[model samples]
Target chain A: MSWYEQYRSRYARLKQAGKPFFPYAVFKDMVVVSLILAALCWLAYFAGAGLEDLADPTDSTYNPRPEWYFLFLFQALKFFPGRLEPVAAVVVPGVSVLLLLLVPLLDRGPLRHPLDRPFWTGLGLASLAAFGHLTWSGYHSPLINPTVEKDPLISRGIRLYREMRCAYCHKINKKGGNIGPELDRSAGSGSEEWLAKHLRDPQSVTPNSAMPKLNLLDDEIQALVAYMKSLGEPFTAEAPKLFTQNCASCHRIGETGGEAGHDLSLIGSARDKAFIKRYIGDPSKTNPDSSMPGFKGQLTEVQIEDLSRYLAGLGR
Target chain B: MIAWVHERTGLDRVWKALFERHVPEARGPAAWLYTLGSASLFVFLVQALTGALLAMSYAPTPDHAYDSVRYITGQVALGGFIRGLHHWGASFMVVLAVLHMLRVYFMGAYKYPREITWMTGVCLLLLVMGFSFTGDLLPWDQKAYWATAVGTNIAGQTPVIGGVVSRVLKGGSEMGAATLTRFYAFHVLVLPALLAMVVLVHLFLVVWHGISELPERRLQDGDPQGP
Candidate 1:
């Protein structure tokens, strides 16, 4: 007999042979299913989800990675290239779904055996394999941008600066408020002791300054100073653009931008390039009470060297 | 005690009719195919419970969505666990639905009288995709933001009607506060209700058509054609 005829006769013989949907079969299924669900709950208790840093629109340093299931599409975008992006983004996936929805309508044969209909069954298997391959490849793809670890002292300084809410008045790299002078570009303007005393009692260093007394401990002031002393003035040439992208927000040369930190018009005269370089790399090394954030790993050493050169050349 | 309640409500008859109903004997290897539907329903139930818990604390807005998620993950007791359950449940449901539809298709269950069941199954698959697209955007992270931009851009490629469709799906020309609200509405309200309705119809059809028996398996006890 033909496959379809054999299938029909077999169905006729088996149609009434199976068990009921309830206690006999469903209950048995439920026992195993319940265990599977409970296992899921157990997994939740053990493998907790990940939480990253708070979303910041301004920080271009971050590399965005989607959830695992969507990674294939993320990887697929790389293949599209430029204006043809819509092909990968839409056309391909779109047509595949349309074909999938049309499967039942297109294939109306009575043959139950998959071998009787090789085309659709083959297509399904092929599509599944393709999706699996794409997902696996996506998971293995390298990160586009990698973030370097922060220094311990700088990390501590950052914590203290945020905790103290110093950013409210004093600007750092264009962030925070415009009430004080910019720190990154205006690094060499303040001496170590002067910077310390200023943090302890702002009125002492700069009379009529609107800054408040944070009432921080000696070590806290030192860490804050360490942070500030790290801010380097931007170098000349291409370094100025880097400064604008990374530093101009808080630091200023004259009247060009924010005044949250001291003016850097004459930063070259106040400190040499080596001193500026050290301060820019890790401000805490120079002024223990500084509030500036160090950019050791954030900026490459070469960029820092160029920026320090530009800073040393300033005011001359 | 059980008999007493049944006496008052006549529920025992209904229970007997439902539980004792002679389903086409889905014996041996063929019975395994029935597993996916029930499993899909179970996953949906779990998703509903977890999703409700998530909604209790979730704030649907541009400014607070990310922070609220952080709060849920970090501060709320078992919040991360609930979120994980919902996340995995969605993926599980999609898998189960696909497997169920495949079984039906391979069995020729969608032929002739069961065409509606097969079509509804396709719609359910579409709903799963919709849920995936909408749920990803709720986190409001960089991944959420940019992926959604790409996803909506895909929607905007819908041939002649791409512009209006994408605009409506995003709730505007650009993704912002309205996009989040609209997606939240569709995710929490619209999809669940629609899914529930479709599920009821699918179940009703299944009950009416009876469980499909495998053509390869022979009768265990006696001939179904016997008088």
Candidate 2:
């Protein structure tokens, strides 16, 4: 007989002997379970919503927090001290894991039934109860307040921003550092809708960005947008158009800008448009080895004129 | 020569008598539950060996913390796999330990002399947590940095020692250079040593107190009946 025919006959013999078959009832059950799990996973994804702005490493006001699922760990860290911080963050979790490992060794009673294993059952129930309690407590923990006092709403928004650690990547005032764009001036210049859109899906605005979608609630997004909009009063004068064309590479005027150069907080006071234009036209005139490469060829005369005018109007 | 021979002969007689007296005439049917303790011990041994290997390549500094881990994974031979093994082993150990405890508790093994064993086992569980907490921060990446920050802040919320605890953990008001070193020390020196001693005591106790027997049934005549 051919090998395949011989193997098939052997398989049939094994099957006839009453061994378990592939694609059995258990397999069907697994398929049903997997479909249910996939549906639930999709639902969770929809619930989380969209991403936030690229994380600004420099912003002191940005608060960094984990997702809701990790809030229990986040909340527990609040109770730990210096060296002991790990005790809560790592040790407690580790011990819980260890206890779980020892359960089989420790609870060696002959009883397979729950009634026969009262102590084990009690331990399991108590653990479940404690986990639920801790998670609830974490979800309800008091929000951190900013050092400076302001309108309650504004202050609360600022606190949320910092607690979320948005500042870590984004710069705001001259005080904050900068891995992301400067936001101190962004509030004055960027529209509320733009800010909201960026918060909702930063990648939609700037592709190849590192900011994860925050999936923030509508109210949370509104509060954050309002807070960003309140950062500075509106600028009225026509800013040098060249400021938009060239200055953004290194300098951020407010919400949207770059990291390579200094932030133009009071650019109108620091240097006039004429000087800014000249600087942009040929940065070599100012410093021989200035890393701020000249953008002379990058912009036309009219565009440069508008950017200079725009920058000169920023401080006021 | 005669005196030495007599001393040696007497010692041999004592050893023979002790072994003959202690040996059980019949061995009981061994159950699957008996394997849990041995399994947990096996997991612990795996953790210890893998953990020690990981410590050799780890650099405990903020500047080099991330880079060192990268290096360990990339440059050190089989370092990445070993690290993964250690991580999984720790999780496995915890799981096995809990299973062991459950088996004992359900068996009513905690009664009588086994109560001490159960209590010691609980302490060991706490130490295992200590090991995990300290080890998690060694990587010093963004995950470790903020996680540690949130953790320390929680400590600062405690009534009396809150500020003191937070300051110590962060090395000041926030996580920085000192935090990594502190966590590394605890992970490598403090926790592992303490855990080793605890495990020794736990094992000693287990050996000293024989495994608890299965519960017996009472006969109509008020005599104990065997299973």
Candidate 3:
């Protein structure tokens, strides 16, 4: 059969076999579609959506993650830093979709076989695979959620701390200001009664102390005290000089410090004396990626011994 | 009684005009591929239905949007299920539409007279993506908040009209109540309306041109030099 005759006959057969565009096909589709929808409702009944904590803009520790479907886009953004970010977020995805839309106009191939449309088919498959891989990795990415679940009283105190902007002058963990001390490390030494007095007026509790009177309610003061007392550590009067001079800049032993280094508030609880001595003397000996400057040449042997002993005493 | 009513209205024409249309024969596995477009349409309708129900209880202000969603999920009967349907339906719609496009493209159905159909399809895909981006920030949870911030920040980084586009998306320098309201309006009103219009046009084009006969079984209909 010639191509023209084949085409005419195909149309003729199609016209003869064609049914009314109504109940016959619509009914079949409705049945399948309704069944699928029912299955979706059933699945939804079993697996409810997850809801997390409310948004707290003040909480510096909050970890943000995108929805599962958007993980690929989110991961892609990580690759393009600074000014080049728009390239990853917009240009690449935009260009890819534009190219996809252009496929129809560009590929005027008569052949429908998958093997014949190698470029378009291969591009689609490759993009799909990359999307699948990126989404999978995005799902498996390390959690950015808050690490600790604070007790109720401590949590209330944290809210108050944020509202009061105490962090403007005082840090908790390694987060606040350097004006006063980091409340996390500094408060560990204060007794509940002492924090209460300090909350009323810092001048009354410690002379020459520049801390302001927060004038907190009694219950709020109690909550703050509870929060402070919870940050417990055995007072290490011996190595205070060394810690203040070196580690305090980065690592927060209790509350007062910068966040560029590890929070050492619980390091004493986790590390042994020997490990501390070696790690602090030369952090690279253990963690190749450790950003801590080695104190090997800077500190005397006696000073290293004192610092390690002080840290080791901070047991969990 | 039903037969009497149907006979008077001549409602069988509805069925005849819709479901009983002549479908061109595709060889082998290719026949199953034709169903994808219908499947995508089905999922989209489902999304529309569920999204309507969701919007009834969804507050469009930041102060209440997140809480309203929580209440819908926790307090209202069947709310959680309806929300899941809407959520999953959006995902399914995107997947199915892409598959439909893929099927059409690989089958060489986009050639010649079908260019308009192909172009409308690309528009539909863009609309679907627009729906996804706008709908995502409605929940106002931590994930929603920060993801939106990052997403909009990317828009803000664009040169020239970057700030303007970002402000339009967010309704201000910061994302707040106005942003949520704008997104709600777009999701429920604008995008869906645009999609419905596009979808109707697409269907009309499909019916007018008829489903592209298998490219392998090419007709020697004019334009001899045509691929």
Candidate 4:
């Protein structure tokens, strides 16, 4: 008899000597499924799924992440840039599925044990390893364009800024009217206290200032100050190269550079330009435990401004 | 009553064939590993039940989808709980399905008479992923909208059929009301039907072939002796 026939006979003998499926197998299945059901209920009750804001098609800064199972594919797409994205997006997954479908046909040996089937076993383990590594990398990778709206106070400040129509008087990002000083340039220079004071009573801070005290509430003044502080000056191309030279040795941005410090890709969401600038000037002033060296006297004021602006614009 | 029903309907024979059949013994850890497939089926059933409950309160249109989901989450009794079950059930299904597939692959259980079972199982796995993709858009939240946008754009990156697939998925050049309705239909109507059919075939093949006995070290390197 052929090996296939021998195997079939052997399997038939094994089946004849085997246990009945109903009580033996069914009992185990019930036990495990009951455990799973209990766990599902526990998770459903405590860790309910979340929903974000309503779909905002106009919000260009929103960063999207796929479900966790697809994160490996999402991360894989980053490696193949430009026209080759199709390879990562389509051909890779298609070929994987095709290979998966063809596995039984390709490995037609009678060896059923993993040790006996080295090649297939090794391939399976390697695929599993790759999947795990890609998912880990994807989970750690920074958001593509982290929106400031992730911060509730900052988002509230944004709404207040829009509602107050501050753009009517001050130019921001060179888009608003030129009736007042450009907010991006002027705003970053003021401390939070100074900005709040100015928002409350402009004449008290600057006697000849044309800005009027709009009779705002304390919370409104705080929000406007926060909005003003968030406005950052535009930086030159030299800013990134400066970051590469000065900070990349100790800091990381996205998938590139070093990792000695906290990742700065989402730093802008946490810290405004003024705070970043102060920290950069003297790390000890803002963070007493910081091991980073001060760069106040080392870099020129213009270069520092450019660098801080570039960093502040990150993830926003 | 049982005999009367069995006499007319012949249900006893079917029950004997399905439940009273013999299965090759698997002891120790191997026995536990055998439960993954059944566990996956259990999770799928959970998903179907919870998904149906969610559908009762959900609206598929772009205009009402977000509000309806919000209302369900915030106001409806046990709505959040059911939605959570469905949400976690999707992840559990993916995890269990993958684990089951991996178990089958490692055990070389797909060889010989079980190839069709493995093939049907792969189709079921793909159907589960389709369910996830389509169900994601039902909430109409920012995460859902933008993720779907990126997902469709990626689909549109296929070499030749890219544009067509993307357009069909979106139901237009852009993701809008049409896309939401299309995804809702697939999530609720099409993918579930496909999943149920594929799952039936896989389970049928399993029963028809019988579960492959755990390969023994004695048979690791040599051919089995003929009966």
Off by over 4 Å in 1: A1-15, A146-177, A187-208, A213-304, A307-316, B1-18, B25-30, B105-108, B215-227
lDDT of 3 by residue, B1-227 (tens): 97898899978765654456676655566656677788888888888888888888988887778779989998888899889888778777788888888888776678656778998999999999889889888888766777777778878877677899999999999878888899889999999899999999999888776666655532367432233
- Model 4 Cα lDDT, one tens digit per residue, A1-316: 2778777878888888999899999999999999999999899889988888778776666789999999999999999998899999999999999999888889885678887788999999999999999999999999876345355555567666666787888876565777778887678778899888888899999888988889999988877777676666668889999999999998999888887898897676566688889989999998899999999999999888889888887755
Name the runs in model 2 displaced over 4 angstroms: A1-120, A129-316, B1-30, B214-227
- Tens digits of per-residue lDDT for model 2, B1-227: 86697697886655443322221111244344555676666667767887788778877887667667767766888776666666655655666676677666555566544556887888887787667666666766544555456666656766567789778776777567787788888888888888888888887676555444444334456332211
List the lowest-lDDT window of 10 residues for candidate 3 chain A: A19-28
TM-scores of all candidate predictions against the true structure:
0.72, 0.47, 0.71, 0.75
Better of 1 and 4 by lDDT: 4
Model 4 chain A: ten consecutive residues of lowest lDDT: A146-155
Give the Å error, residue A194, model 4. 20
Q: Between the candidate structures 2 and 4, which one is better when assessed by TM-score?
A: 4
Best by DockQ: 4
Q: Write model 3 residue lDDT over A1-316, tens digit each, in one string.
A: 2544454465557745654444444555566577767877776677656665555544445566766667898888878988788888778877887876777678764455566668877877888899999998888877654254456787677657766788898866567688998665668677788889989888987899988777789999988887777665434466877888878888787668889987776664456577888988899989999878899889988788778867765533
Across A1-316, the per-residue lDDT of candidate 2 in tens digits comes to 2433443343344334431212232243355445433543443334321222322223333345543445667667668866667678666876776765565556643333445556766877787566667768888776542222335556457757876888787776554557666776555567777778878898998687677889988888888876775565333334444455556667887777888887785565445567777987788997778878766777767666666655654553
DockQ, model 2, C-alpha based: 0.02
Error of 1 at A110 (Å): 1.3
The model with the greatest lDDT is: 4
State, as a TM-score between 0 and 1, how close model 1 is to the true structure: 0.72
lDDT-better candidate, 3 vs 4? 4
Ranking by DockQ: 4, 3, 1, 2
Candidate 3 CAPRI assessment class: acceptable
